[model samples]
Target: MASVIIIGGGIIGLSSALYLSEAGHQVTILEKGDLSDNCSFGNAGMIVPSHFIPLAAPGMVQQGIKWMFDSKSPFFVRPSLNPDLFSWGIKFLKKANAAHVEESAVPLRDISLLSKKLYEELHQRGEFDFGLVEKGILMFYKTQKAAEEEAHLAEKGKSLGLDMEVLSRDACKSLQPELELDVLGAVHYRCDAHVYPNQLIKGLVSLLEKNCVRIARNHEVSRIETSAGKIASVAAAGERFSADHYIIAGGSWSPAVARLAGLRIPLLPGKGYSFMAKEPEGRMKIPALLAEARVAITPMNGSIRYGGTMEIDRINTRVNLNRVRGIVEAIPKYFPDLHPEMPAEKDIWFGFRPSSPDGLPYIGRSKKLSNLVIATGHGMMGLSLGPATGKLVSQIVSEQQPEIPLSAFSPDRY
Candidate 1:
């Protein structure tokens, strides 16, 4: 078995380590942070097969333009003269068409289903409990436009063999009887699930360590040594770690990491925020997506996690409380009884999602580097798609056929 080194200890890197180690390969994960929190941990924790439509779909450009003016809008792209943003925007505009969405649906659904199945298997093993719940997710919509959009999405999901049903306001209330909803209706994505990400990440780290996988925390990759079109070693924290194969799973920093290896990964860091609020009443039995507001609310660890907003810009430490206010305000509009308070800046958790121009993740072997794999660009679906991406990475490294076609997620597509 080959020795492997994975950069960026988020869900993608950890999941890759999990499968690589299971395949008998020696694996090491180099994490810049202490692995205490990341996009993997702070998310709403919904495993959504319902999100088949890529972010680059049609109408997004117009909607994003309208949102840019709103301080607390769900999506905002910082206006900038940066060449990277300009180039990414051009690519995004080119792909935001009906054809692209139609072409992307199948690939997205397949990977999502694969990951959901893997999650179930992991939960069944009972090695650790991450509070994996398959009660499904509800896409709640108050406006007629949002309701129509969700209904259309439900039809598409059903056509793709997913279990989805458009429900009336009464039907929706029946599912979560304790909460008083003011929404017009909801689409219940019965194919979706949720898990407590904190437990999942910690449990995976423990399991990997027990299986002899070295997890080097506080070690950030500073340099990539290459020779003959292949990576020879990675330098981090005054040490050089050599491995037979290297995988770049560095979340939003993937572009910087790839640059060290003389590769350009067209990606942007979309910063999002979330906070945990008390849900002592257990009013929410199912996860919910506010369709118009673009907020996600999920019940986990006996608390409700409210997350939203997609601010496309350079990764930064500043938290925009206005966006958090948007999330808080939207909750009461949908479920009138559930009102989340505006969390303090210190309480807010933010993470950068590695969003690609085309809204599809890059998940294949690099064309320039024979022994290198690129597996970031998951955007908001990193946790939802982690295991499947990891399993595919293992298959690629083992010289076996991938369980699904990789043409859609090819790292060399650009």
Candidate 2:
């Protein structure tokens, strides 16, 4: 069995470790932090097979431009002179077309369905409870424009063999009778589900450690040694670790990690924030995505988690309270009966999402480094796509056929 070293112990890295260890490989995870908080946790926790459209779809450029001026808007791209950002923007513009969206739908749907199936299997094992619920998610929209867009997406979802239905405001209210809704309509994505991410991450870490997978926390990779087109070892925290194979799953920090090996990954960090609020009534039976506002609210762990905003910029520790307030304000606009107070800055949880120019994750072996597998740039769908990406990484390392074609997710596509 091959010995593997996975960098960045976020959902992608942890998931990769899970599958690799299960495949009889000696696996070790090197995490920069203490594994208590990461992008894997503090997310909306929705496992959505409904998000078929990539972030680089048509009209996104115009929409993003309009949103740039608003401090509390759902999307914001900081104006910068960085050449990487310039290059990424050009590539994003090139791919932001109807054809790109059409071509990406199948690959996204297939991987999402695969991940959903894997989540179901994981929940069935009963090793740990992550609060996996399949009650589906509701995409609520207030305006006719948003409703029309959601209806169109629902039709596309139906065509892709996903269960989805456009419902009227009355129908939506019938599902969540306790909560008063002020939406024009909603699309219930019956194929989607939710999980408590905090439980999921903690449970997976415990299970991996019990299965003999070494998790080295506070070990940040600073150097990569390559020999004859393959990774030889990784140096982190002034210590050297050698493995037969290396996988880079380092979320927003992947570009820096890859740069050590003389590779450039065209990616950016999209900062998002979320906070928990008490929902004593437990009135929200279904997770909701505010269409126009771009916020996600999910009921988990007997509380409600509200998250949103996509601030494309460098990774930083700054918390934008305006964005969090936007999330708090939008909740009451949709669920008139539910009003969550704005959380303090300390209560807000922010993480950087590694976003690729083309909106597809990079999940294949690197062409320059033979023993390295690149798996990051999942953007907003990291938790949603974790298991499927991990399974594919294991297959690639094992030299076996992947469950799905890898052309769409090739790391060397650029």
Candidate 3:
């Protein structure tokens, strides 16, 4: 069996390690930060097959431009002088179309369904307890126009055999009995599941260790040693280690790391912000997506998290107060009974979602490298797609046939 080396020990890297080890390969995961944190730690833990729509859907370009100027808008693109950022923006705007959306929907839904099954199997095996809930995701809107647009999406879901339910304001209140809901109508997908991010990350870390997978934390890969068009070793933190195969699951940093091995994958970091209301006053029993605001509020095992805002800029760890304020502002529109002090606290947390211009993740072998696989650019759905992506990568490394078509998520598609 080939010895596999994976970079970036977030959900993608850890999941790959788990799958690779299960396939009888010796696996080592290299993480640049603490195992307990990163994108994996601060995400909306929803396994949503209903989310077939990619971020680059049509009209998003114009909306992004408008929101970039409006401080309170949900999505914002911070202006920058970086050429890569400009290139990514251009490609994103160009690819936003019905055909592209259609091309993306199937693979996305299929992988998400596959991943949910895997997660359920893992739970049955009793690997971890990360508060996985399956009551479904509620998409609520305040206007008839919003509800009509969402009903079209619900129709599409129904055609795909997804368990979808449409609800009126009274019906929505029945679903979420405690708090006052300001919605006019709702589209609920019963196939979705939610989890606590921190719990999942920590539990997986323990599970990987139990499986004899080596974890190299706090060491960033500085250089990659390649010979004869294959990986020889990876240089990180003044040290080099050899492995038979290498997987680049480095989230927002995948592009730069791939550059070391002479591969160009256009990946930009879409900065996202979230905050948990410590003792949240209002009630949010089922996870709901505020349609007009494009924000998600999920009730974890303990805390309720309100998260949204996609800022497509270079990977800068800067927290935009205005964007954070936008999430805070957008929340109360649907849950008008929520406490007003939600956004007042400056204890803000932010992480980058590795976003591709086309909105679909890049998964599969790199065309230029025989032993290197690319699995980044998951964007908002990385957590949802982690297990399936890992299983696919492991299959590729082990010379097994892919379970699903890779055409929708080809790394070299661009």
The models' CA-based lDDT, in order, is 0.94, 0.94, 0.86
Q: Per-candidate TM vs. native?
A: 0.99, 0.99, 0.97
- Badly placed stretches (over 4 Å) of model 2 are none
List runs of model 3 lying over 4 Å from the truth. 279-282, 343-346
Clashing pairs in 3: none
- Whole-model alpha-carbon lDDT for candidate 2: 0.94
Compared with the true structure, what per-residue lDDT tens digits does model 3 show for residues 1-414? 989989989899888998999999999888888776688677888889898889889878877778777877778777779898889988987889888888788888898888998888878888689888889999999888888989998998888878898889898888768878777988988989888888888998898999999998888899887888898889887889888889999999889889888889998888888888764543677898999888888887656788888877777767778777777777777887775355654566788999999999999998778988899999999999999999999999998998988888999988
Per model, state how many residue pairs clash. Answer: 0, 0, 0
**In candidate 1, what are the lDDT values of residues 264-357, reduced to their tens digit?**
9999999999999998889899999999999999999889999999999998898898999988998899887887788989999999999999
